[model samples]
Target: MATFRKHGKSIRVEVSKKSNLQLATFDIITQVREWTALAETAIIESKSTDIVSNKTVSDTFERYTEEISPNKKGAR
Candidate 1:
């Protein structure tokens, strides 16, 4: 969600998703709204990419733990 507030002569914009938060101050309300929309879109896109990338890492680690790690000298 995005929150807007007045800060002195400028407008403060805040966008948050999960544990990530972004903040910006702009002199015009339209600028703040535009920034907020962009910020939210970027955050959502990053989250989708992370899920796809993490699956690759998870599969590699699982294979190592099950098949390769047990054969190592110090695995005991």
Candidate 2:
């Protein structure tokens, strides 16, 4: 299940299932809920024992620019 708590301006999301736990924070409630649902589904489906990652903010942005940003309306 996912636990939600208000952390100042952002919302903290904690999802724990089986012997695994995942934590994340988002400024938007919809984002938090979406992530929580996906995490729970992955856990219940036994996708992996560890859902945590070592990804950095810069790496995520780089991936977005390469894979997603180019598909946006302004991309040429």
Candidate 3:
């Protein structure tokens, strides 16, 4: 679900905890609705969770630093 609220002069729409889809100025409420629908559909159809749920950002970065970094140009 997307929540819309006023932000300065623009409308901010939060799709989820990690996702934010911005809307244009307050005058363009119609476009905001359309864009919201498109954004929501794109998010749903993208299967984004499948790409991210494999590992957390901290874990992935730590693994890279522990393993891949050693093979990089400089490893002390």
Candidate 4:
């Protein structure tokens, strides 16, 4: 799981994994950075409003799970 918060002008993102896989940890961090960049772009494009305010952590998690779940099952 991951948690993200904003403090002043910067955003802080933390990622945690239940498994002991080192590769999974690296992958999660990479994914988070990618998502953060996409979100930043969205904010820049939508200059009228704040991007973080329009986004929900739950929504992001759901989308991520949906994308990865199929691959996980196939691997098993």
Q: Model 3 reaches what TM-score against the true structure?
A: 0.51
- Per-residue CA lDDT of model 1 for 1-76, tens digit only, reads 9999998999988898855788899999888888888999988777423334346877989989999999999998
Sort by lDDT, top down from the best: 2, 1, 3, 4
Instruction: Please list all clashing residue pairs in model 4, or write none if there are none.
Output: none
lDDT of 3 by residue, 7-72 (tens): 877776656423634333444668778867776776777744434556788998999999899998
Model 2 TM-score on a 0 to 1 scale: 0.62
Error of 3 at 12 (Å): 1.2
For model 1, what is the error of residue 53's alpha carbon versus the real structure, in angstroms, after optimal superposition? 12
Error of 3 at 73 (Å): 18
What local lDDT score does residue 75 receive in model 4, on the 0 to 100 scale?
A: 54
**Candidate 2 lDDT tens digits, 32-64:** 989999999998999965655788889989999
* Residue 49 of model 1, lDDT score: 39
lDDT of all the models against the reference?
0.83, 0.91, 0.67, 0.52
Clashing residue pairs, candidate 2? none
lDDT of model number 3: 0.67
Q: Is candidate 1 or candidate 3 better by lDDT?
A: 1
Q: Model 2: which ten-residue window has the lowest total lDDT?
A: 48-57
Error of 3 at 9 (Å): 2.4
Q: By lDDT, who's the top model here?
A: 2
Q: What TM-score against the true fold does each predicted structure earn? A: 0.59, 0.62, 0.51, 0.28
